[model samples]
Target: MEGAPQGTGYVVNLDEKLGRIDEHWKPRVVAQMNDYQFKLVKICGDFVWHSHADTDETFFVIDGEVRIDLRGGPVVIRAGELFVVPKGVEHKPYAEHEASIMLIEPCGVLNTGDARNERTAQNDMWL
Candidate 1:
C-alpha cells in the first residue's frame, strides 16, 4: 500500500516485490532501464564462485547482511550498502541468514556467470 505504484509511471516498492519471492538463489526482474535490469533475490548459504567476463555485477543489500568472497578478501555488505564486482573478477556471495538484495546488471547475464550447475537460475523471471 505505502510503496505501491501510483497512477503514473512505474514506481516499484522493493519491500513489496521482495515479499513475493519464496526461494533462494532465484532472481526476479523488478525494473529495467536501457539495456540493464534491476533484479531482486533472497539469498542464504553459499553461492557459486564465478565471474562475468563482459560486464560488472552490482549487489545492493536491502535486508540482513551479505558476504562477498573475493580473491583479495571478503567484503561484507549490510542493509543499505552496495558493492560492485568488476568484470572478470571471480567472487562468491554468501549469507548466514536470509538476506534480500538487488542486483543491477545487463540483460542476459547469468546468475552464475560463466559457471553452470544446479545453482544456475533461469533468466528473465519477473515478479
Candidate 2:
C-alpha cells in the first residue's frame, strides 16, 4: 500500500470498499505492511472453530459487534474495539447481525486457520 505506482494514493475509503462485498466470512485485502495484510470482511452467524499455528490474528471491529468464543470464555468486541487471538489459541467467532471487521495477519494466512475445509476462504483475494 505504501509503494503506490507513481501518482496512485494509499488512502482507501473504508465505506466504499466495504460496500463492494456481498458475502460473509470472505476477506478482501485492502492494504499491506511488510508480510502482513489488512483485510476487510463482513461476517454474520457463526464461524468455524480454528487456530493459527504460526501467527496471531488481530480483529478490529468497524461496525456492529462480535462474540469470540474462546476455550475459556467469550470475548465480545463492539464497533471501535479490537482484539487479538494469540497464536494457536482455538476459538470461534459469532455475530447476531452483520459485523464489519478488519483482520491483520500474515499474508496468505487462511481464514479458517488450521481447520481447512469447504469453509476455508481463498487467501490473498485483493479488493
Candidate 3:
C-alpha cells in the first residue's frame, strides 16, 4: 500500500484505490482512524439483508448508483452521495450495474452483519 510517510498524512485517491478492486462486495481496507476503518468495494446486483447490532454503516458512492432497501422504503444513492444505515436497521444494497463505493465503519464489523453466509467477506484486508 502506497501511503503517506509517518507523521505526514497522505492522500488516498479514491479512483485509484478503487481501480485495484475487481470482485464485487469484497471490501478492501484503504485507511483507518482510531477504531474505525475506511473500506473500498465494487458492488453489483443484490446483497443479503442484514443489520449491524452495535454500529451504523456509512456508504459513500463513488461511481454508478446504488439502491439500499429498508423495510420502510428504499433509498437511492448516486455517485458523490452518501447514506448511513442506522444501527440495527435491516438494509440490503443493490446495483443494476457495477458500482464503486466506500464504507466507513468500526473495525472488525462484518460485511454481512448478523446475516453471516457465503457472502461474508474477510475482515481487515488492506489494499
Candidate 4:
C-alpha cells in the first residue's frame, strides 16, 4: 500500500515486519524525511553521556525499561512511556536488560549524542 501524500506510510503487520531485527545496540530507520526521522533501537548496557546542541530528541519505550540519567536527576521509563530530552541537556541512557526504543529526532542526529565514539553508527540503515 502507498503512503498518503502528507503522511507516513501505511504499516501492514508491523510485528511481522519488525521480526528481522534481533541484534543489540543497533538501530534501524523506520521512516525519514529531509529534516526528521523515526528509528527503532535495541539497547542494553550503558550508552555515552552526551548532548545534542541543536535539536531535541524524543524517546518512546517500546519494551522493557530504560533509565535516562539527566544532568540533575534520573528518569526511569517503562514500556508505553515516553521522554524528551531538550537540546543541550547532557544525558545518558541505559537498560539493564534488552529494551526496544523508538526515537524521533531531526535527521542526522548522532546516536551517541556528542561523544562520537566507535558506537556512533553512520549509515541510515533502514529496516
Candidate 5:
C-alpha cells in the first residue's frame, strides 16, 4: 500500500489546507481512508439543492456554522459539530459567512448530486 509523508502515513493540517482555498463550494481532498475521502471546503451564501442518490454525505464543521435546508425543515450544524444527510434526501446547504467544513464520503461523489450544473466540481481533486 502507498504510505503518506511525515513518518505517520498521513498528517494533513486542516487550518493550513483551508488557508490555501479561496473559492466557495469547492472541496479539496485532504486524505483518504480505505475507500472514503475526507475533503475540506469553504462555503458561504447558498448552495444548489441536491442529493447523493447512492451514498450518504457527512458534513463536519471545522469553523463557523452551516445550515442545511431540507424539504421537511432546516438542519443547523454548528462549529465542532457534524450532520449527515442521508442518500436520496434533497437538500440545500447555506452559510451566512465563509464557513470552513469537511465532508466525508466515498471517493467520486459529486458536490452537486441530481442538480448538476456549473457548480458541480470534478471528482478526486486534491489540495
Candidate 6:
C-alpha cells in the first residue's frame, strides 16, 4: 500500500489540478491514502442542511468566505480558516460568491449527508 506523504508533495501542481473543477456543488477527490481522502469543492449560494451520520467532515477554506449554519450556533469560515463539523450535527453551508474549499474525510463520505437530494452525486468525480 502507498503511504501518506510525509510533507507537502511538490510533484503535483495544485493550480493545474484546480483547473479541472468545472461544476458547482460537486466534490472531486484529488488525493487519497490509507483511510483518508482529500476533496475539492466549489460552492455558491445555500446548500441543503444535513449531516453525516457516521463521520465528521472537515472544511478548509481556500478562497472566499463560507458561512456554516449549525442551527443554533453558526460560524463564518474565511480564507485560511479550518472548521470541523462533528458527525451527526446538521449544518448548512452558504457563500455569497464562489468559494473554494478542501475537505478532509474518510473515504466514502456523502456530500449531501442523510437526506438525498439533487445535489447528491452518484460517483466521486476526480479532478
Judging by lDDT, tell me the better candidate of 4 and 6.
6
How many Å off is the CA of 16 in candidate 2? 1.0
Candidate 2 Cα outliers beyond 4 Å, as residue runs: 1-9
| TM-score winner between candidates 2 and 6 | 2
State how far residue 55 of model 2 sits from its true place (Å): 0.5
Screening candidate 3 with a backbone cut-off below 3 angstroms (N, C-alpha, C), the clashing residue pairs are none
For model 6, the stretches where C-alpha displacement exceeds 4 angstroms are 1-10
Q: Write the per-residue lDDT of candidate 5 for residues 8-40, one digit (tens) a residue.
A: 266799999899889999888888888898989
Cα lDDT computed for each candidate against the true fold: 0.92, 0.90, 0.92, 0.80, 0.90, 0.82
Model 4 residue runs over 4 Å out of place are: 1-8, 12-14
Please provide, for model 4 over 1-127, each residue's C-alpha lDDT reduced to its tens digit, 9 standing for 90 to 100: 1231323565633355357678776677777665687778888999889999999999999889999999899999999999999999999999999888888888778888788888887646767
Query: Candidate 2 vs candidate 5: which has greater lDDT?
Result: 2
| Model 4 lowest lDDT segment of ten | 1-10
Q: Write the per-residue lDDT of candidate 1 for residues 1-127, one digit (tens) a residue.
A: 2343323358889998898899999998888888888999999999999999999999999999999999999999999999999999999999999999999999899999999999999998877
Which number leads on lDDT? 1
Model 5 misplacement above 4 A: 1-8
| Model 3: residues with Cα > 4 Å off, grouped in runs | 1-8
Q: CA lDDT of 104 in candidate 4?
A: 86
In Å, residue 113's CA in model 6 sits off its true spot by 0.8
Clashes of each: 0, 0, 0, 0, 0, 0
The CA lDDT at 119 in model 2 is: 84
Whole-structure CA lDDT of model 2:
0.90
Per-residue lDDT over 15-47 for candidate 6, one digit per residue giving the tens place of the 0 to 100 score: 566677787888877777677778888899999
Question: What TM-score fits each model?
Answer: 0.93, 0.92, 0.93, 0.86, 0.92, 0.87
lDDT of 4 at 79: 94
Worst-scoring 10-residue span by lDDT in model 1: 1-10
